[model samples]
Target: MVTSEKNIQMIMELADAFGPSGFEDDVLTVARKWAEGLGTIEEDHMRNLYIHRKENTGNKPVIMLDAHSDEVGFMIHSIKPNGTLRFVTLGRFANIAMSSADVLVRNALGEYIPGVIAAKPVHFMSESERAKGGVPEISSMVIDIGATSAEEAVNRFHIRIGEPGVPATKCRYDAENDVMFGKGFDCRIGCAAVIETLRRLEGMDLPCDVIGVLSSQEEVGERGCKVSVKHANPSIAFVFEGCPADDTFTEPYAIQTALKKGPMLRFMDVSVICSPRYQRYVLDLASEKGIAAQASVREGGGNNGAIINTALDGTPVVVAGVPTRYIHSMNCITSGYDFEETVKLAVATVTSMTPEQIAKF
Candidate 1:
């Protein structure tokens, strides 16, 4: 079983791995290593990871767990005549946040080289350019590794076209406040939660079979999970996420996903509307068990749940979201207590269920 120390380490290692959409080999390495004792691991060309619980029995209903592995990143598009590199975003990025952000470029040799996203300095900008600015166009940005010419970048740095990169932020845990600062919490934190959940359920005998899926390329439109759903073939799915927190920007009365509020159970997101019966069941269960939780009707977000819910003759799905601040940026914030409570609520949901109750959904 994974202990507290091990879980913390796993979360950090996952956050540190540079996995950008199509290049998820490094993140898969971390997940595959930690999922060693769970069961046999399986994958396809898309790198969608899956594991059946060790205690599963063939006759029970299947309960699938999903957490995406890839994080938003950049890909080298071209090399300039000067030493700087031209790039394109691999997934969603707040364009304004790119310039000056610390980055690690995976060179042609597969080694991560430190670099910084660069743009024209203010002093060098024309009066006309200065008048039309609000973070320059994404296409105008470059990654500078202190090279003097394009030839230097290719020969000395081994930088090339098509290589992917991620932010260079490292995971940091604050024990006193239980707040964790890191990169890729959007789904890496969810990935950690799924693995830890599997560990917690190591030998438990329930009326259902459980499996965890760490899908690839989620940031690029849930591409990996569209394939994972066919593989897991679950009767139900619990999609976990490091969901964006609204507390900071939202009005007090409208804050639906707040940090340290256990986890958010979505009623609806752009991707899917949760199964009403299953959603209510989990909400009631959380309240009865005294688990901290929040519910929301999201206007602009989607997840693996949408794909899984509609797959394989219609599977019921729920999302257990860990509220994260500033997702898709170079850094993010989440709370350890929120992760613990999210796991607790899920464990209770799994153990307290039966085939009869599930049929209601």
Candidate 2:
């Protein structure tokens, strides 16, 4: 069977999970189920999930494979007298894209109640209010779940302050177009890649020990990776991410990340300058193996790669990403081709690595 068919369903489930930064329980649940028997599974208080490959020999150098298990979302800050919810963003979001967006609020009862990011209707806006261009700050916005008053929201809906919420979008695959539409692809796509890579390497005898980490709370400043890096101190690392695709809006010549082109190997983003030697090696390996891959120098954005790279006096790290369009929003799109290529590249990298080669990095 094709690799895509084997793992795409798990990818969809990861994308649909209700995890947002500090609240990564649901995401870990899905990951653990898919990773069962792949290795020894372990989790920390911070909810970081680690799978130590059964083939590992403690004497060998560790190869850390990472993918965060959180998505951009919101947290309820307060309940207004009108029963609307005032909230704060758990991670960054384009405020303009938030108005009237569908959301699922996790009330105190652990129930995800349906709601919308309420926006002021055009007809209700005064002339001066309308004069202000663009959307209001997210702090001023509220989520409405149809409660008549604060008491009703508290008693009937069981809504409480500090609850988490996520975009209310379902994941769907377009087989004809080879595209996927969903939320939380930012790192969920990466999570699937890490799992599939481990599965492919199950019986292989490599020179290095492999540890796959589905880290948590990445969107809130790479908190989970900071912890997992200490646990899996390795000589090298690969961070799989669902990176923002630039093809649709960027100038043709300036575009480095594009869908269906392949997985992107970024030299550097705002966070870290990746180990140049290792990055070049991976790129060269991709060329030699005929795996579809792209390279980019991002002006903005960051990932767990930055954290792992600097940890333990530095480790050579590369960020391989699926070109996901509309990341950090309610909906995102990625190609099935990109995902497959990523898995192949990851497998090749592991199989080709040796103690001598890692020492060179």
Give candidate 1 misplaced runs (Cα > 4 Å).
1-3, 128-134
lDDT of 1 by residue, 1-361 (tens): 1127667788889989889998989999999998999987888899989888989886788888899999999999999999898999987888777879999999988899999999989889998878877379879899998899999999999999998989999999987777889899988988988988888888888899988999998899999999998888888888899999999999999999999988899999998999999999999999999999899999989999999988777788899999999998998998887888888878888888788888889
Considering only N, C-alpha and C atoms within 3 Å, which residue pairs clash in candidate 1? none
lDDT (C-alpha, whole model) for all candidates: 0.89, 0.93
Q: Model 2: runs farther than 4 Å from truth?
A: 1-3, 131-134
Among all windows of 10 consecutive residues in model 2, the one with the lowest summed lDDT is: 1-10
Worst lDDT run of 10 residues, candidate 1, spans 1-10
lDDT of 2 by residue, 262-326 (tens): 89999999999989999999999999999999999999999999999887878999999999999
Score residue 164 of candidate 2 by CA lDDT: 98
Root-mean-square deviation per candidate: 1.9, 1.2
Candidate with the greatest TM-score versus the true structure? 2
Could you tell me the TM-score of candidate 1? Answer: 0.96
lDDT comparing candidate 2 with the true structure:
0.93
